[model samples]
Target: MASDSLLLTADFPRTVRGYAPSAVDEFLRSLGSRLDALQNQLDQQAARCEKLTADLSAQAKELAGYRLKEAALAGALVATEQRRAEVEQEAAGLVERAREEAEGLLAHARAEAEQIVGEARVRADQLVAEARQARQAEEARILDLCAEFDAAVETMRRTLEAHLALLPEPGSTLAELSLGGLAVADAPDSLAQAA
Candidate 1:
């Protein structure tokens, strides 16, 4: 760990016999030169290591950010999948409810239609019966009128015959008596003809 200045400035103890000062100085200088070269190489390596460590630190930070992003993306995917499932389930439930409501409405409509048809049939039958009864009543009334007319004609004919019988003989006293513009003798024949 000695520096070049430290090696040059070093002191040695005097002895009866010892290594030469110049030789020691020459060896010290050579060792110092080698150490300087090694130190330069070591400094270069340390700087490279520092740069590599900085790059690694930055890469680690970037990697951590990427992991955070991945986790967030994964969580988002899971939430999205769950939302989709909920939506699908809700849609299915809505469809089922709609179908049930439709069926119920259809059944109600069918029942209403049937009731309408049945009521219509009953009303139609009542109308037809009423018409038939009215027609029968009209026919009976017409028949009664015809019978009354015939009975009135018969009564008139009988009254006329009785009056003709009360008249006198044709050429005797009946001729002397005149009834209205006709002679009494002709009254009986006129009455009979009228009857």
Candidate 2:
């Protein structure tokens, strides 16, 4: 029982030492934040898919209901076969009316679909544009940072080379040196200028 209580000791954290744990904790926090963002985006996308699926299911149900009503009418009418022949005889006239109705429905559906798709396409384009702009900004920042780093590194190399020139080598001067042997000298300000 006492050993079980010892397991619950909160003072263990206060006893820990060094920057190692703190650095690890910072890295974990950063990783957690990124993962949380990804999770949220995934959740949003899942919700969108779920809603779209539900809407499509409802539309299918409505269309099925219409089909059932049409079938019921044809079944209840005993003279359906005779009427079907008459309807077929006037099919040419009805065909035009049906064509008009179908065209109207198609136009409406197309307009609605276009409205939804256009809005989505616009939103997607905006998001893509924003992402591209963000990428460009990040790339510009990285390029600037890289240029600064390169300049700093070149400066450090030049300083080191200058210091190295002040030290005496174990061997001879530049003109006295063979092809493979190194000779000590200060670095030129610019290789292009030296050339």
Candidate 3:
């Protein structure tokens, strides 16, 4: 029937001067046992090969996943570097703008301060000129007053000298009285006219 069963069944015909029947049967039985042992060993070796192949396939898949992760990490690193460069450029621009603004403010402040100083100088000059003019006017007025006072004093001195010349001497007083009231009255008229 089955090939396996056919191989298990063994029939050896006996010959008179040939192999012994018991010895030939014993040899066949030992060969069957050896063949079975060899078959079992072959089956174990096939199972081990299959297991190793499966492990190799799983390892290949893991390697591919690791490669993908590495690629992703590389891309992320490149992107981070680019972003850092962009930020640095923007910061530099901002710093430049701030510096320019500060410079402009400083220039404007200097201009304003200069203008204020110039105006102050002009005002101070004006005040000094006004004070000089006032002092000159006061000096002129004082000089005029002194001149007027000197003229008044000179006029008074001349008037006093003329009045003194008109008066009689102490010895002439008796002669004037003896000459009568005419001389005394005439002397008063001369003094009044001179004044």
Candidate 4:
């Protein structure tokens, strides 16, 4: 045969006596629902935060790429500016060389012109002197020939009158006589034949 044991319990306080069993049950159920709603809100906020963080990181990476490209372009710009300066310097040297060459050529041309003018002046003066000498010689020859011709004419006049008295009434004229020691055949035979 088995025997059963009885259990004894202490009495509740006055505040605990006014507590309703159904009311306690309702409060616990409400609390559970509120906790579930809060958990749902917190989960949504965390998901939004993750998406925003991912977008911000993507934007930062894109900005870094843009900055790198800008830096490369800046380097290229500097290189171009340096090359331009070098080219300008080379061009300036070329211009100076060209100007020097032009000046040298101008000097050479001026010297050549002066030399040519001087030569022409000297040649012209020589030709003028030679012409003057030739004219003086020809004039002196004419004067000498005139004096000899006057003497010969005087001798012929005295002899011609004596010879003309013995001749017939028809007399020889000056045109028929040889004058200035020249005859009709005075030129050389070859020259006469060619003429």
TM-score of each: 0.35, 0.33, 0.37, 0.32
User: Per-residue lDDT tens digits of candidate 2, residues 1-195?
Assistant: 333233333122433454465565666666666666777788999999999999999999999999999889878675788887788889988899999999999999999999999999999999999999999999999999999999999999999999787655777555443332432233344632442
**Candidate 3 runs further than 4 Å off:** 1-8, 80-195
Residues 1-195, model 4: lDDT tens digits: 011111112233456668775665566556656666676788888999999999999999999999999999999999999999999999999999999999999999999999999999999999999999999999999999999999999999989988776553467653343434444257556744553
Q: How do all the candidates rank in terms of lDDT, highest first?
A: 1, 3, 4, 2
Clashes of each: 0, 0, 0, 0
Ranking the candidates on TM-score from highest down gives 3, 1, 2, 4
Per-residue lDDT of model 1, residues 1-195, tens digit only: 557668767778867699887898889888888888898899999999999999999999999999999999999999999999999999999999999999999999999999999999999999999999999999999999999989999999899898887665677553475566676556877663553
Error of 3 at 37 (Å): 1.2
Q: Which predicted model would earn the best lDDT? A: 1
Error of 1 at 108 (Å): 34
For model 1, what is the error of residue 46's alpha carbon versus the real structure, in angstroms, after optimal superposition?
2.8
The TM-score leader among the candidates is: 3
Model 2: residues with Cα > 4 Å off, grouped in runs: 1-94, 166-195
Candidates' C-alpha lDDT: 0.87, 0.75, 0.82, 0.76
Candidate 3 lDDT over residue span 13-112, tens digit each? 7778988877776777676777777777889999999999999999999999999999999999999999999999999999999999999999999999
Query: Candidate 4 — which pairs collide?
Result: none
Residue 68 lDDT, candidate 3, scale 0-100: 99
